[model samples]
Target: MMTGGPEPDSPDVMSVLELLAVGAPPARFEELLRTARREEAPDSTLAELDQAVRLASRVQALIGHAQQREAGLAALVDTAHDLTLVHGMEALLHEIARRARRLLNFDMAYIGLRAADDEGRASSIRAAEGETTSLSVGLKTFEDSGLGSLVQRSGAPAWSPDYLADRDLPHSPDIDAVVRAEGLHAILAVPLGYGTTVFGTLYGADRKVRHFTPDEISLMRSLGRLAGVAIERARLLEATRAEVTELELDTSRARSSLNVQRRVEAAYIRLIDLVLSGCDPQTLAEAAVKELSGALVVRDCVGRTIVVTGTPPRLTEDDVLRWTYDAHAAGCPVPMPDGGWVAPVTAGGENLGAILLVPDEPLTDGFGVRLLQLTARAVALILLLQRTSTVAHDQIRDELLDELLSDIRTQPRQLIPRARRLGIAIDEPHVMVLARPEGGPEGRAAAWASSYAHRMSGLMRFRDGYVTLLVPSEDPLAAATAVSEELTPLVGHPVTVGAAGPVSGPGRVAQAHREALSCLEALTELGNLGCVATPQQMGFLGVLLSENRGVGEYIRSVIGPVVDYDTQRFTELTRTLDAYFASSSSPTRAASDLHVHPNTVSRRLERIAELLGADWQDPERALEIQLALRLHRTRRTLQHRHAATGAARDAGSPAPRGSGP
Candidate 1:
């Protein structure tokens, strides 16, 4: 309906535009227009004001619609995270349908499962929500061309604006009758299944004729996919429960004997208590040792002894391996070469380790053997829990490292929170250690590195034949030595380690890696493959081998603090060091050379120690410090001579003879 009014000019339109900008309501706008009319304002002004109000109203409606959709999407995300805690299939399906209806504001939503034999041709509604009539539930359809059937066949969403009036797609008479009776229209059906296996369809319908937006259709499809995954998980959980129940029944029947039953019951009770108390491998081994009449020994999968009690016969690697194979094959305790019994610690057919029970005498009784086997199972469980925890922790650490190392552009501030979650204070001074085991399997070394890093509350990454760890230690050389010492025996071979940095922040991790690599390369070049060293320990050779040729950095790293202190206070520590070194370690001679008392030279040396470290005079550190002092003095002398020559030349005088090119 058009209202007669004069055409709008620029001035009248601008006034109405200002009203619209403030979001003035139509009522206020109408009042303004009425006042304008009373004031004998032009018809164009009234018309323009009316138009602005309409525009503002439409914008508000659109904004409100957008916010509602955003809230619905957020709810969908929450539902996905919540689905993991659901247990029953029926309850989960019902929840899925209800959420879909609520999120999409549908009149009704239902889930339909296709018949197993008919293959998308026949389906019956399994769950429904927001249904006005009970007929929607228990509803069955057999038509091949129905909405649900089509969605099931194609594994895509199908919709019709008017359910009964749409002729492009065929519909079953019974289904149409229910829809007509319910006055339903604007129906949508999306297939629910994982990947290529289409098992069912989810349908959303509205009573009034409406067009579902693309987002609404996509939301329904996402719900369908999530439902499919949830269904799969539920089915797997049920299967696992059934298997556990059956295994328990079989175990009970196997332990039917009175003595065996008593032992089994007591052992199982103790095992549960051990697990609930968060017992470690050593504790579990100790419990087994207490039960045994003689001695017990536990070793990890790699033949590393975890716990030993009493005077158990020493077993060589071959002995352990052979006995382990026999015990695993026999599925119980087997006799050891020393007349003892050994049981394989295993979980889900994976070998975790072995437990050896060396009783005082040979026991032919089944009870002793069964007890040994139970002990092994407990050990397996403990080890499995430890392995799982270590794996999860390592995964998080590796993720952080991946972000740091792979992407050099990643900000350290962004990774601080993730590092803190793993108990790594990334801002604290830390050293980077790079280790390469000279022998043993790389995988074993990597596993050990991961476990070691976790135990030390550090992060590690195994890449390109090297295991890199970022440990919170200020002394890189000591850290490297410790890693090599600890890993060498465990790996059954030499492990070369190189280290760099007491870097204060994680941002310099990449730089530390490069420096550490240079140390490693320098060691390898000198045939020092089974040793530990830092770039500072490598001396001037480190600068030559390093890619960055960090000679100035190396010199500064050793003597920069001393030089800075001397510059700030105008001290003679640098001269004292050179004189002390030149006088063949004689403080009297250095004092005589400096023409000062020996006591003054001693005080300067002590200050030098304070500036450097207490270990500044250690053989290795002293060598580095002496090298830094010589290089620092030489560079200074060259600078002074060059400056003198430049000044002489600038004064129109001949340069000094030795300084000439």
Candidate 2:
């Protein structure tokens, strides 16, 4: 195998020594030695050259070993730097495997992390580099066999040259198969960790049978220790980051809570200021709406609107009432249509009203709802105060009305002042209206009367089972008629009203009241239920029913013969006489008025004269006949009107077509 170096016969000891000292090829040294021996130089010279060549060869080998160690140490320094910079455990493991294969000149290098479960324990290859087949990353091995287990258990480096033949350690058939498949003949591994806590092992293997030097094993151990420290450092950093994140979340929550409190405080201050300013319910509601940037409607207990602010959601009265009921029951704000909300305005357990709010946008949280509740409470207080004031005023007015209607006559001096205080001018002309509830509950009639009287600025009270109002008016009958029409629908039944007086002062009130009562009685007696009447409108019937009863004498004298004729014949000769007189005694006009021919009228009149005396045609008697006929017709018309009303009443309907006398 040695060629082109030196001839074997030539003696060249100095030259070969020079070549050996300068690190020439082994072939060159071998050729120089062969030439020195063939030259047959002196035995001492041959021996000296041989010793010199051997010494030079030994020195060269030492220098080469030193340089390799130096290079390995430099690579270890670079690995330490790389490990310190690596951020994750897996990346550091891969880098360690790569550096190990490069430094040791192994066919394959890999790291195996120890994994233990309740069922069993094993080492799984986590990272690998170089030419690997069966011993790839994620390969697992049990502790019974494999170099990983030996290194982990002993906490030391392990190596086996000619791994298939080594029998000092237990070998698993499966592990051997993997090693053979990987074409590995030698293996070296070092425990990766500090002290006795070996997390895993780093492995390096060669395809050819070769011994692993101690320096290489030690270098790998150093790298494994550095990898373990790096992994622990990464874990600590990750835990610190988690803690920082949680702290930030808590801080954000605290800030949000503080902000909410501040806003609530500000809103409370604004509400208190509004209340102290004596603002009306509407004004206060508007302020609240402005603050919340929403619309609101406030309603009273009876579902009447008290105030409305902004353009609240469109809802019917029934919708508002339903929402109010639900909110009151729940004692909280409830959602409504169009992104609105409703809250009951309650005070001292009384649901005074409700407030409906329609926001410009939907609420994102409970704060807006809570704000609405606060506003509702403010509105409730305002409503309660208003109601209390109204009740006190009504009490005063009711007391005054009671005194005015009292039967005991009070001096004008004593009454006028009291009347003026209640906004009534007792000295002015006022009519006394006596109203009787017809086929209806008296209590509701009285309540409605009181309310109506208040609206008219008059006085009302229940007296002698009648709801009476003394209102300012010149036409008592017209006022009575107006009251009847107005009260019919409200009471859900008919009401008969009888009015008397343009009574001038408080002194004449009792007399006027008696007149109204008598008129009311006359209406009932005449079958005129649900009718309005005054003494003047009742004509002669009114005159007959008056306190002065002398008009009966005049009636009997003027129409006695006709009355007797009617009683005898059971005919309406008296009605014919009355129509004749009403038509100015013209036979033709009288026939037309009675819806008959002139012959019938003339014959009736002749019969009436025959029943009395022929002298009834004289002017003195004729004048008397005319007056009596007029009175009789008045009575007959009233009787017919009464009959019609009675028929209607019997039918269980409203008053007949004609309303008043």
Candidate 3:
């Protein structure tokens, strides 16, 4: 066989060549000797054999090196080209695995890519010539094994000199079996990085024990750089495609918005369903949640009977109180979930509950106001629909009014629920309201209400001709006189307002509301009031509570004990004991405020303490009684205030001061 070596026919030259077999520069010696023999000095044949053998030996070494280099270069170039041509990350990975196998001259090699979720996966593998492999394994997450973790964490370069001895690789009988099967003796894995961002890893292995050469490492690093470039190109292309997709999506959304308006008129149908179909609170909440959540990310959405401060699962009613947009707000997030946000609202400003959408991710540079407007409008529409529906219309109206007081017009007990939701302690002065616009239908009234509602973000109604003004004024007479004289000229029409004294919470709303309404009816003419009437004077609560004993029961369930206990622990007997003390006890103001004879007041005080327990002697308990007494007086005053207002409106007067604070 001709193995690219010299012929061995010459006689004496063979002896020389044989002698030179293990010497350095043997080819040069052979050439020198052959030149000498060509002169035919008589030893030419001997020299020829020596020269030919040396040349053959030199040629063999050169050919062997060239072959190894050729193999390595061809494998690397092919891998790069293949990876570049692959459609996706996985295909590139597979090609990498194949190349690693070929260039490593090893039995097994694996290629793993970085996962999006802070993980790495050995997703591709290849077996070298003469190596056996399992039929199943092609791709798997690194979380499946410690070896993968070690490779990923050690990001620089790693070597498992003896795969079996690698503690980090995990102990597996199967691993050893696989290693043996694949004929892997040593392994090296190097990280693939794009600039500073690590993308994945490249690995090489050999069947026989071998040192991973610096040259091999160098080549792999070059491949890594190539990988980075290719990946970046792919990423750029992907980004461009995503931008195009988003543009299309935005256009589709715009079209859908127009289409959505067509279905908006079907709100009446939804109202019917809500009323007749009996959607429970959970269902209603779920519906609201789904719409809000899917369309835009919101912090929370809640429809409430009482929009109070400390509430949860509800964005504050305060946000809706005076909002004027569509009377509502709704819109999807702008930019993207992570990048930016936007929202739009519908309902009229009169409808006061607000939707608050918040992105799960950080928003773009600036979009706070947009989010607010969008949420307000969207929530307003949804709530307005809930409110104006024939089903539970009165109840919805009452609740909406309560929520509206969160800030627009004035605070009321109806708003107490919201305060509670918002975690604010319930202790604000409040009043009842009653409104009747004599000359207008509901639509006209609503339009009129809008002007005022917008003025204060009235949370109750997303409409107009709304009654929103300070009620339960400390100076009810002064207020009446002022409103009569001032507002009459402005409205150019008569308006009478019934006022209730200070009150708070839904517990007392009805009581104050009925009286106010009565007072309003008593005034046949709307001659001077800025507002028709407030709930305090309407005094609807006492009657409503009498009919709905459950209302009292509910209140008792929530906070009755404190009121009852404090009343007894603090009030009765102390009144009688006060006379016994005989001290003047700040009598001048007390008498003036009480409008009672000092002697009579003194006698009543004496009677109070006698009934109280001996502990009543304690000054603290006296103060407690004083407080309870004040509370009772306040309630009665509220009840009585409506009549006082009626007297004022009857006389067609107003308070002297300007209503604007």
Candidate 4:
């Protein structure tokens, strides 16, 4: 504000000095030079002014460069912070691209991650920013692209002033087209990582031709390094999570296996306990069914049900048959329609039986199948044990029965006590039944008879090649008939049985046995195979065939003369007598029965009377004669049958030496 002559510090000069101190732009300093010339300043003053302007210009340039560097530093710091906050790779890459453009002031900036395919020959742009054109975020660069290829191959930062004209790196026509379309001339690219394991490339481009400075290239490399660290960290974290999940799954499976094994062990212990306790087959099966919460059925070798337990599904005979076949064939537990299982029970490689288990719920693992198999094994053992015990009991009973049927030397008092010990009530009214199997082995018939006798609470033995059973019954004939019917299927053929007495005491057993034997023989001689009979069933034939009957004395007392006449003259007087008695003594009926004339019948009867005496026509004598005739006829018939049997044997026998081949 000083006036008059110019002051030591003029306003214009002070303004210029202030601009120089503050390091203003070169243009401001140039204005100061113009002011100094227009005021016609001294040469030394002008020179000082020019020197100050020059110095200020240099200072201004340095300050601008420092400020730009500080701004770039701040942008880099922000990028690092943002990267830390980024969780996703795509987001992190996009943020890097955005920061790069803002810090470098580029026309376009993008990040490309290498494809994971073989050779990593291509890079796909994952993120982009500051694009004037419609920028495709995922633009891909080929193997021949100049910027991406040079950066990846060199594993360092790379750039080109004019990418289209560059010949130092491979050039791609498609990349060039995209670059031209985007109006991009200058490009800088840096590998995302070091060495051969580079993950991707980072790019910055300008629309105008430009020479990328070393500092700018270094900045791009820093961004690339930061992106690489993030990508690697994300991959490691994902891998760790996967490994942890797999470990947890393995631990869970191990625990499930342990639990199943524990349950199976407990089931096995329970089965052993049952066996040790001497529980019967039925009891063991019931326990298994209850523990398994299912239905259980145990069958014998013959397909007969030994034990059935629990609320099982209704099974038909056809279903049982099918299951048996399947179980036997598979030799393991077979799954059924109702979430059940079937297994064969075997011992000594013999199919002892079959077991069916139908659970309330489906078995999820092998534990249920294992349990069923163990149960079947237990059942097999029980069945085998029972069979052994049965054989032992049969042996003991057979011994006692033999002694009881022997000679009277073994007193009834001693026999009774032994029979009592064997669970037989010998003092009770009992019948002696003798069973003869037709066309069946004696051993098989004896064993079957013993089993049958045991079931009926009787005593049985194989004596003199005959299966004899001493049964407690009031009616011997009825008992014999019952046994015959039961033995039909067991023997697999016809069986003839003879029974005697409802004898009151053990002392009468011997007599009863003899009578039963006699009845059996009479049945054979009478051609009544497969028939059951008692001594009383033989009628008058019973007396003739009785063990105590005096056959010759009886015939002599009745038709003695006729028998003597036939013996001496070798005539058929006995046969004529038999015919007369069979026809009720009517001459005409007798002739018809003999196939002769009535007069011939009459003459034969006259001859019979002359030999037997005239009183033979009386009722008492006639009854005797009739009885005697039946005895003679039975004897004759038996002799004829014996002769025929001998003839048959001779016929059936092979011819001695000259037999035909």
TM-score of each: 0.46, 0.35, 0.30, 0.38
lDDT-based ranking, best first? 1, 4, 2, 3
**What digit string (tens of lDDT, one per residue) describes model 3 on residues 2-66?**
22234434335554454445343444445546655665546555546555666667666666665
What TM-score does structure 4 among the candidates reach? 0.38
- Candidates' lDDT values, in order? 0.75, 0.72, 0.45, 0.72
Q: Which portions of model 3 miss their true places by more than 4 Å?
A: 1-63, 119-151, 165-184, 205-213, 256-661
Model 1, span 409-435: residue lDDT tens: 534686888788779898898888999
Of the candidates shown, which would achieve the greatest lDDT relative to the real structure? Answer: 1
Error of 4 at 287 (Å): 3.1
Name the weakest run of 10 consecutive residues (lDDT summed) in model 2.
384-393
lDDT of 4: 0.72
- Minimum summed lDDT over a 10-residue window in model 1 is located at 1-10
Considering TM-score, which of the candidate structures 3 and 4 is the better prediction for this target? 4
Better of 3 and 4 by lDDT: 4
* Candidate 4 lDDT by residue in tens digits, 153-255: 7676888998887777677777777788888989989888521257788889999999988657756776676666555544433443453455356546788
Model 4 ranges with Cα > 4 A deviation: 1-269, 290-293, 299-306, 312-374, 383-396, 436-451, 462-467, 490-498, 514-661
How do the residues 1-661 of candidate 2 rate in per-residue lDDT, one tens digit apiece?
6444443455556776567545577767766667766767778878877887787788788778769866876766666656556656677777878888887888898888776462326888888887546356667778778777787667778889988889897788877887878888888888765223567788888889988776676666666665554544444334434534544565467786655545544674577567545568988887887767877788765455768777765687567767777898899899976678889876535446688888887877555776787778667655543443343345446555656666765345678887888788888999989988775545445546656777788988764557888999999888998888776654557888888888877777776777888889999998998898876666555565444334555566557767877888798888787777777778899899889989998889888778768888788777766766776668767888888788778899787666443
Top-TM-score candidate index = 1
- Decide which is better by TM-score, 1 or 3: 1
